[model samples]
Target: MSPRNPMNARKQRIDDLAASSVVVDDAGTVDEAPGVSLIASAWRRLRRDPVFLLGAAITGLFILVAIIAPWIAPHDPDARLLIDQVSRQSNPIPGPQAGFPLGGDDRGRDLLSRLIVGSRQTLLVGVAATLLGLLGGLILGILAGAFGGAVDSFVMRAVDVMLSIPSLLLAVSIAALARQPSQWTVIIAIAVVQIPIFARLLRGSMLAQRSSDHVLAARALGVKRSAIIFRHMVPNSLGPVIVQSTLVLATSIIDAAALSFLGLGNPDDAKPEWGQMLGQAQQYIQDYPHLAIYPALCIVFVALGFTLMGESLREALDPKSRR
Candidate 1:
């Protein structure tokens, strides 16, 4: 055998070094822990946050009350009580008694029972209106974001027009136009007012996503426009929308209550609705303050629950918050 060529010897030495450097793990599976997703990280942060925990607890309690109102309520929300018969009182406006813990309203309905059952209606209206607004806003946002130029201009301009009008005023107008003023009418009115807000937020988020590096990369890879827009763009930009949805739920509840207060909610007095209860309690407000106090407290605390959760979620999901 001739003396080995220098270049071949050098190549063999390099290969030997490269082979020696390789260190494969004995385990078949990957040993490193899996990377946590953004949502998982946000959830972890939320769980650790006291504010979020408090809000979640309150919200859960209210939801539980709403769900089991009928079973938990001591008296039928519609049932009227005559305190004069029970307590031999000359005064008509009744105060708290054995059966009625909170108090009695002007029409002698059990305030506690009404409140318990009203929670169901209030939550229903709030959730339904929010869903309606979210659905409409999502559609408008997707249309504007996916199809730029005329479509974007038109949708945005329409949104701006809606935003220009006072939300409460617009809701009142919409409700007034309806054949019958009912809970659904109130929901529609509130949802209509909310459409512009969600539309604008989602549109802005989507527009920002459209220019993001991932979206650009997807486009460069010849991905279908629909896939790029729907899968990559929409999903990534949904964080802000979801956070906003929580905030919007609080506003929606307030709007529903306002509508009910204005006599634009369910006209039927028998149906236990918080706003309707508040409306009925107005006359006896000075006489029996508890009537207003209890319902008002319920509304305030529920709204607070949503607000705290929404804000905490917003903070947790914010990119700047990441270490």
Candidate 2:
């Protein structure tokens, strides 16, 4: 029989709106609640992206291979089988023969097994190198972004210097300086080259977010500098960096292969790697091109998987792409 208070009416309307908003469950299912977050929406978009699905399928396959290579491989990667067939004692570089689906290498090692087992090394180096660069870049970027002035200038200058040089050349130089060209050496080399890319990306992200509303609110509320940085600024800046890491992983894999192809990879060919296998096959390309083709194809497919995933994520996360 009486009119309601305007404030109470407004509150009721707000509650109704909130109740009608869509929320994303842990499993990514949408339900009626508060509005979905940007990340949740991005994830939904990614699931719908054919490109992302394709990439995920290929990436998952490679990851599966990396994890189960040893158990699934029919022979040890280093096992020399029927050398006479390879060394021309009995036959000339046999092609896809019995017990060797992909044929044997110059050393009579089964190409199929080596390729299978090599997935572990390739994925390991790619992931490790990307993480190494991501860690270094995060440290430098946060340091420079949170504490500008001399620190920022110095860090940016160093990054610029590194950027000026060709990334592969820098990696090659680092590998050359190492005591020996091993898997670790190749990882470190590629990681060093990747550092500047991530550093610059993160630094720019941080700087852009420094003036954002959340950051200003945190500062106004007297939040500790570290809390504002780690909880507010850095967290907000990570989406692009995370996407960039996937792309960097693809590059890292290629860089590792390049180093190995240049004869700067693992010293021992006994433990076969995709790059090392390709390298050894080079001299015999004219006689047995299959040896090189398979490894090269593996590298290409793996890289394509990462690239597609990264690009799809980028598109999904980009606000403009929603249109």
Candidate 3:
């Protein structure tokens, strides 16, 4: 046997694994280290990545706080425990005292408790909107990708029309036009704005995979057209879409907050959303900066966490990242 044959075999193996993740050991042997699907590989990468870890920590802590708010909050978020403190006389909005750390809002509610409880509303809105958009996008993207020509053209053109408008402006318009403003209005508006984005991304990804080897091989074999599409093409194409969903969660949160701030959020002040809290604090912002600062910081930090996780996931799932 020629020594070069072994080298050629090794080279062949390298080429085979090139499209996937490869690990080279000290012996110089190549192995498909993460012998798993794209999602499994991405999860492995996520576990080891500091950026993802930090983001996960922030995001997880937020979820935990939201879930346990009722148990951990020092006072009832809606109670006017400190209404006397803000009587517009001596102590106009008292600063942090015994029970009320971070002081009282103009409404005399415990600011700390409202901030804690508000996480539930924010998370609910963000998750709901993202899921809604993801569902709509999946349907449109599948139709366009699975059936090309007319369907593809029609869907793409419609998506193009949506893309032409600024996302925020579109959301604000939709939210503002609603007969009654509430969290559902914010959710619907945000979801509508997000649908086009997700649809376009999925369609592009599916199109790229349409001509790939696995798809062509399935066609060559006797796989049903629908089976080839859903079983192979759609699964393979979902990597980018999943990554985009994470990013959209952050965007949805921010969008929901924006609508809420613009008086388009839940009208029930008793619920105490972070965005509404921040909005209401504007008038008293001059004297009581903490009112605006706390909720604003919460929004920024949570958004940052999601954005970080999304970016890290994107990098992790990228085929180019395989080594």
The top-ranked prediction according to lDDT is 3
Worst 10 residues of 3 by lDDT: 22-31
TM-score of 2: 0.88
lDDT of 1 by residue, 21-116 (tens): 666675477559889998898999989899999999999999999999999999887877744443435555677778777767666778788899
What lDDT is reached at residue 75 by model 1? 87
Candidate 2, 192: how far from true, in Å? 0.5
Cα lDDT tens digits, model 2, 136-174, are 999999988888899999999999999999999999999
What TM-score does model 3 achieve against the real structure?
0.87
Off by over 4 Å in 3: 1-37, 321-323
**Alpha-carbon local distance difference test for all models:** 0.88, 0.89, 0.90
Provide backbone clash counts, one per model. 0, 0, 0
Candidate RMSDs in order = 6.1, 8.8, 8.7
lDDT of 3 at 208: 91
Candidate 3 Cα lDDT to native = 0.90
In candidate 3, what are the lDDT values of residues 154-267, reduced to their tens digit? 999999999899999999999989999998999999999999988988898899989999889988998999998899989988989998998999989999888998999999
